[model samples]
Target: MNTVKIGWIGLGKMGIPMSQHLVKAGYPLNVYNRSKDKEDAFKAQGIGSAASPAELIQHTDVVFVMVSDDKAIDDIFTGENGLLKPEVSGRVIINMSTVSPAISKEMAAKCIAQGNHYLDAPVSGSVKQAEDAALVIMVGGDATAFEQVKPILEKLGKLAMLVGDTGAGNTAKLAINTLLGIVAQGLAETVTLARQNGIDAEALTTLLNNSALGSPLIKIKGEAIVNNNFNAAFALKYIAKDLRLAKDMGADTPLAQTAYKTYQDAEAALGEEDIIAVIKHLG
Candidate 1:
């Protein structure tokens, strides 16, 4: 196979290792980051650097964006020095960012108008899973483009599923995050209550991991909370962002109203720390 020339935008906690994994696997990569310090790790990996989005667009056949939110994606694609404004062709932009479904749809249409393909390939996993290539990816948009990129995507994720048409990935990811918040709230609240009553948090986590109701999420995230590791496997800010997206989509689910309020309280208490920091609020 000809090495796929990839334009990797965003070099945060997840994006850094994801791009590094691709580089380690011998993919031709050109990386761009709004923050220079974050790019330092990749720079040591012999990845090419682009000072601007347009410069980055010049060097690749595909653009893999693992950014913050809709605004960050919009800025890269349609900002003053937007990638879309450059003279480019034969490109596919796979956004692994968990953005709003509405924004994903709009960006996909924009890519089509510019004669490029787009995929809303939002992911399920944190920075740790991302580094380990253990993420469950949720993708939506053109099937042909997805097929063409499946090899690369597989290298980055363990379970890459096609959910539906344009915007479906973001929609699914947001829905997942909403429920994840609720589950985290329940887990944290329960563990804190137990700990307060003299139950060992670690023992409870191990017990739950072996129980029918246990999941990989609770096992790993619960362990983090038990250890008081506030390292950003996933941040409260990102979860809060997804909760807001869920609230917009939850017109049919009034119960989601309650979860959103809980996330709001937790975020305020924790100052937008890691997902495990929600347990701090509970404690």
Candidate 2:
């Protein structure tokens, strides 16, 4: 099979490594980032760079976007230098951002109307999983389009599941993030309670990791909390955003609402820190 030409927009924490994976897989890749420094870095690595989304779409069969939020998504598709030009016809645009399901469906409709394919393929992983290409991708769009892009997605993730028609991927993503936020809050509160009662935080984490409650996230983020390492693997601000999206989805999300409040306070103080930094809010 011929290698599919790939174009990528957004070179944030996850996007950088994802695009690098495509380049490593020997696919012809072109990249565009709003930041010139990131675009220049891609150029240094011998990957091509485009001035705009429209420019990027012209050169590739598939375009992957991993922007920040719904507003950023809107800007990329409808901005002056957007990708919805006439030449985008027949191209596949896979949006891997975590946005509202409503926006995903609307964008999918627009892309289809313009004779292009759209996939709302949000991912489940942090910086480590992204770097290791171990993400679980939930994809929603045309089944044929999903099949066509499976190989490409596999280069960036361990598993890619086509959940349903357009917007389902984002719906699934929001659900997963809701659980993640709740778990993170639970872990944070547990750690704080332990620390306050004179128990060693790291020992508590070790105990948890050895217990039935242990999980990859608990072990990893629990360790981060114990060590007080608040680096941005998945920033608190982003998770707060996801929580808000989940709340707005019209579900009876009391637990998620509580977690949302916790994250919101954490984000106010340590927005740029990792989601694990929510523990800091307990003090």
Candidate 3:
């Protein structure tokens, strides 16, 4: 077994279960979260908790960060108490957060300048999937760094791969999410419309399940419409955030602008819910 001692940042819905899988796999982990109580799962799993990023940096081999966004990524990696302080060298930072490709590029530069390695490794899966260790992971970084971290990543996901470099993975994730948002919103609108026309959504869903457009995206997510439960596996706020990123991408491609507007409209309709609930905006 590769004794790469573990370090993780963030402990949200996704982070908690992933950390559980890490410790259960018997890798020594030192985890840190901004909110103290968020660190409970790590502690419960016998993984050590750090009072701050600096302390956490002091204790591990590779640090896996599943933080919120670019700002949080900056604060943790380059903040005063950031892990990439002048003194620390030879550490690897794996970001599992979905961030802008530009930011990922900048982060890679900072890590290299500071003699550390950085990898952008985002994932696709709901919280339940995360708990079950079945997420599809996309990685981009220095090949050696990815090789070093691949084994640890395996503990957190079922499918994992190093795509291109630094920002490539983030770009891929954004593209994938953008399409998902479109289809999910499309599903939401189609069903809601069919219902308004006196068609039973359940029956429409049954038919769609066998149609060419029958995608697992609809199969798994169309149920959210059938049952008005919108507890987030992927939150509305985050999808809105992603569309904002899409808008940036839109500068180069107008379609992205339309998608951003779509997400904005969706966010307006449903203040907050699972991302799939964006369909609620269709009415």
Candidate 4:
């Protein structure tokens, strides 16, 4: 792992911590971010900085991307400085963004045509999990490429499973996120109903945490909802985006559809808040 030359694109919430883990694990790290400050910050830590994705590709054997959406991914990899440019080949590009599986398939095809390897490996976790290197990563694409990077990925996640062929990772991620959106909404509604019926919000939250219904997500988000701490661990807008993608993919997601609208409404008022802030839309 230490001998692998790794490059990272995207330096947002999850990206920053995930990349930090790679650097700490002693992989030869290079990074590029559209924001100069983020790039410079990593450079100051002794990691190499690339002027663009094209340049980053020149120096690294594997490039990991954790950008926001399909548009962002396209912007970084389709322009003059794009990763798919003629000069970039024979490298592994691992996309860890939660995006449409269709888009992932398209990108994988393009990369493979250019003599590159692509893996759609999106993670299931929030900022805390990223920081603690406890994320669960779902991967797809060539089994050989997956094995090559499995050791590196393990340094950033507790579990890394190759779900299927290209785009399957994104499919799995969307499926998991659908459950996340629905459960989050359910928890929000349940807590709000308890408060409305004159039950103590904090006590109800504690009771739920100690019950079989308790999950790590419910326990963490439940505390946030009760205390009204809406600081973003995972932004509500991103959750809304994932739900929208799930809908676009024909998932028959009625519950996710309702949860999507709830998140969209909450985003209008608390766009930058934690996903748990969807509780604010309750009652």
Q: List the residue pairs that clash in candidate 4.
A: none
After superposition, which runs of candidate 1 have C-alpha atoms over 4 Å from their true positions? 251-255
List, residue by residue over 61-166, the lDDT tens digit for candidate 1: 9999988988998999888787888857679999999999888888888888988889999888887788899889999998898899988898898988888899
Instruction: Quantify all predictions' global Cα lDDT against the true fold.
Output: 0.84, 0.90, 0.82, 0.90
Model 3 per-residue lDDT tens digits across residues 1-283: 4487889899988988987788778788888999999777567756689877878887887888998788998899778888877457789988999899988899889888878898999998878789999998999989998887788888888998999988878888888888777777778888888998999878998899999989767887877767777888888878778777766765335556665677787776564688877766667
Clashing pairs in 3: none
Q: How well does each candidate superpose onto the true structure, as a TM-score?
A: 0.94, 0.97, 0.93, 0.97
Model 4 worst lDDT run, 10 consecutive residues: 251-260
Residue 24 lDDT in model 2? 86
Task: Tell me the tens digit of each residue's lDDT in model 2 across 1-283.
Answer: 2488999999999999998898888889999988889788888888899989989898899999999999999889878888886456899999999999988888888888889999999999988899999999999999999999999999989999999999899999999999999998899899888888999888999999999999999999988886779999999999999988888996456897788888877788889999888887866
Candidate 1's TM-score: 0.94
Counted clashes in each candidate structure: 0, 0, 0, 0
Off by more than 4 A, model 2: none
Select the stronger candidate by TM-score from 1 and 4: 4
